[model samples]
Target chain A: MNSLKQMLPEVAPPSREALLEGRGRLVAEARDEAASAGRSRLLKRRINPWTALTAGLVAGTLGVGAALAVQIGGDHRPPERVRLVSAAEVLSRASAVAGADGAARHGRYFHYRWQEISLPDEKSRHVLGSGESWVPAGGNGRGLQRMQPCTEGNAPDCDVVLNYKDGATDREGFTGPRSPKYLRDLATDPDALLARIRRTAKGDGTADDRAWREITDLITESVGTEPKLRAALFAAAAKIPGVVADMNTKDAIGRPGIAISRPGRSPQQIIFDRGYRLIGDRTLAVGKGGPEPGTVLSAYVLVNEDVVDRLPAPRPGLVR
Target chain B: MTLPPALEVRDDANELDMISHVNEQVATDDEIVTWSLRDPEVFATLYDRHAPAIHRYIARRLGPDLADDLMAETFLLAFRQRARYDTARTDARPWLYGIATNLIGRHRRAEGRFWRAIARSGTDAATESLAERAADRVSAQMSLPALTAALARLSKSQRDVLLLTAEAGLSPVEIADALGVPKGTVHSRLGRARRKMREALGGIDPLDPREDAIDE
Candidate 1:
């Protein structure tokens, strides 16, 4: 039925500007991560001068950050207050409210209606772009998508589709390409879990920065673990060596929250609300176009999330 | 889209910034992956080269928001698995589509609803409204509910083959590759799908319930 072809219009590419802006961040991250495979290869062949030098530099970076944090606090371990509180302190406090209830539902899903606002870091005449979507709880299974491409000069153009994340348990992350089942099987001791996660962590950073970023992945997007696991995840985060506190930050939703950031060439910020719940994150994108490099490339604020039996569709009025 | 003061924070301690200039070289996706093993920076080149299409493909199936989110996941997973990429397969598009399809399959119900909604209305209001090119828009409009309804009636496997062929412009071999099925299986599924579609559209009353039961 060619008639059906007409109904299923040709899918459009995202606006040229939106593609460039968003894709810029992904490319940069890929570049950084891709190098890890080679780095590990070098690490395997111990005693190479360059490898030794790189190792020394990484160790030096972590060593300095941890030394300073510990020096400021003195001889007090867990249950002992980390006087230099950061994400660890906030996460530890939040974990107390933890429970083992998974995100599964009884003939229901965690439905979310969301909007994406894409802003450019360059002055390339790319107007801001915004799009909306409605997703089912998990892959309810079946259908087609008609992606409408938004181009420059056509401000309102955008595509929409439906999603339920296909019921991924641990959600998706770089921590060893494992599933939520992996998290479910993790030890209750946050330290043991952190060690296991560290094995999967990439980057040329200290143990702390690597672990901190991994923790950020867990609480932010993935189907957050059970309460006890979440608590373990946060307590584990506290132990990351270089995590620094940033009490003055807000989520993409503009809600105030405590932020824990790991310093690097491109620092990543993870935000949590006063209630200790995860909210959102921001990354400093240093692209070629902007006058100054550090632009907030991509970020999202969790506006609302709830468990409902029926897939939630935004009222016709809210459809952008 | 400047950030509010509270949402924007920076670290002066990060003095060693990545070189803003990326010396990009034209290379096959395989070469890029190979180079990435030597220099991670090369992965960004692959990202810049391909993520837009990947994003659109996902957006078409799931919508923009999830497209944005899943696009990131797709790349990260791709990055982790780069070592396993078959160098002979220079074009990464099929592989990327496969990754996206698996992700889409996860939310099969949402996709079904999206397709049904368009089918019921016989049009997508949002796209139709701004599709300045009236001629192209008109053809894609007019009547599509029958197609969507028939699509919904097909088993998920059959429907996937049809969409990959129709929507993604993939060949039978690519569809087989993307779905991890044999080429023969892809052809069979597509053949059955086309037959059912022909019956649905060719018949006077596509909406008839009796017609839908013939395939099963």
Candidate 2:
């Protein structure tokens, strides 16, 4: 019997080629119908407040233009010597600390880290959702540059980023390097950036105002204490209308810190130290109705002075 | 007995290296869509790549005719969904199998009827063909009635994992993606399905246990 088992090359079932052929024809014919149906559904779509919140969180990690000006030591002058940090440095440090390790690659837009992180949330408590990604840098138009956390099993905790490319809009919430021109200077003369962003949103007249209103709402919702800083930041954001800022404050490995959400249709959050150095970001979406509030999505902490690592491997696989 | 050269080539091509090459080429679901979209004629490339084996799987379950229909439907659906295809994934087989599984689910009644008929007949074309071809036929023909009854009793999720892995040749990760479930869930479901199938078949040793077990 064992010999027979050895002899028989275990035959798998028949392929579904014939079946799929028929379905393909049907789908081609039904494309118009399906598309119409899909369009109708899209038209009736309501604004999901939670989606906006998650988008905000994702934008934070990607380093969107929504910077909060905290009064540090009553220094009114914008710090000339602001230190710039890359996303990769942050991810590496976090990966080492979390002990959920993985490798990362750097791209133009953002640093991609792929690793497993513990989710204290109900939806994915200890579930493994690890994959690679293309995280943007701090600067403008740095293309996607990294891939990490390639694994065999399906990790639902991981976020699959799609259409990440260089010169493309930072739609997915990943950012590039810090602008060579200081943001403080840009804040003073924000017409170029704001107009560019507003034009992208096709903002005209009322639409443009509405876009500005949303930006103001986010600023007020995010940092309401300092009216002066709020006004400055809001002006900057409005200058680049339709460019939403995702922000959050979370505890990374027991340390209080803030994270910027990556921007895109599906946003991700990046963690940072108080010093504004990129630590790591939450790569996975958590919670029940999407990513839950107050959950540690990702963290990149400083292990040593010079070297930093991503906590987990970036989610693997691209969608489009 | 004269050995045919074509048969020899066929045997050589079925080796691990060849299968792995095929697997590597079609490693992710997205790749499959890309390949199909790049050249619609290559749509048949997938069929030529996986049809025989899938045919064998369907034949094992519901004989030949139903298998043909199911297999056809699977590819057709895959082709249609190719546009919104996620290119990150390289293997298209699992996604194709997922669609096929859904179609099979719709024809559950027909499949059940086929199984009952085969069990009563005490002859399954897949099993009988194997018995005829092999020198040793012991345990070659599983109790069709038992297998059919057991399969019918198996939970939908379990059955999905088992069939997808065994017949569709998808990895656990791929199966999870296809089913939109977690990897652990796919593992547990597959395990449960196998255990049930064993129990249902009276723990009869697998008729032709493949060396590469599904889990491995």
Highest lDDT, which number?
A: 1
Off by over 4 Å in 2: A1-320, B1-32, B35-44, B125-144, B204-216
Q: Which candidate is the best by TM-score?
A: 1
Q: Give me the candidate number with maximum DockQ.
A: 1
Model 2 Cα lDDT, one tens digit per residue, A29-68: 4455446656765764554466556766776778762532
Q: Could you report the DockQ of all the candidates, in the order they appear?
A: 0.06, 0.05
True contacts kept of each: 0.16, 0.09
Question: Over the stretch B74-177, how does candidate 1's per-residue lDDT look in tens digits?
Answer: 77777778777767777777777788788888888977886677677765432424223323443332345666677877877887787777656678888887
Worst 10 residues of 1 chain B by lDDT: B1-10
TM-score of chain B of each: 0.72, 0.67
lDDT of candidate 1 vs native? Answer: 0.55
Give the per-residue lDDT digits (tens) of candidate 1, residues A1-320. 23333345555445434544555566567555646656875676666676656755776777774654444334322112211233455566556434323444445554332333333543222213333222333334311111223332243443333332332422222123444446656637987888888887787666666766677777554432345666677777777765555544554445655666554333466566644565656665534555355454556555555455554343342222
What docking class should model 2 receive?
Answer: incorrect
Alpha-carbon error at B95 in model 1, in Å?
Answer: 0.7
TM-score of each: 0.40, 0.34
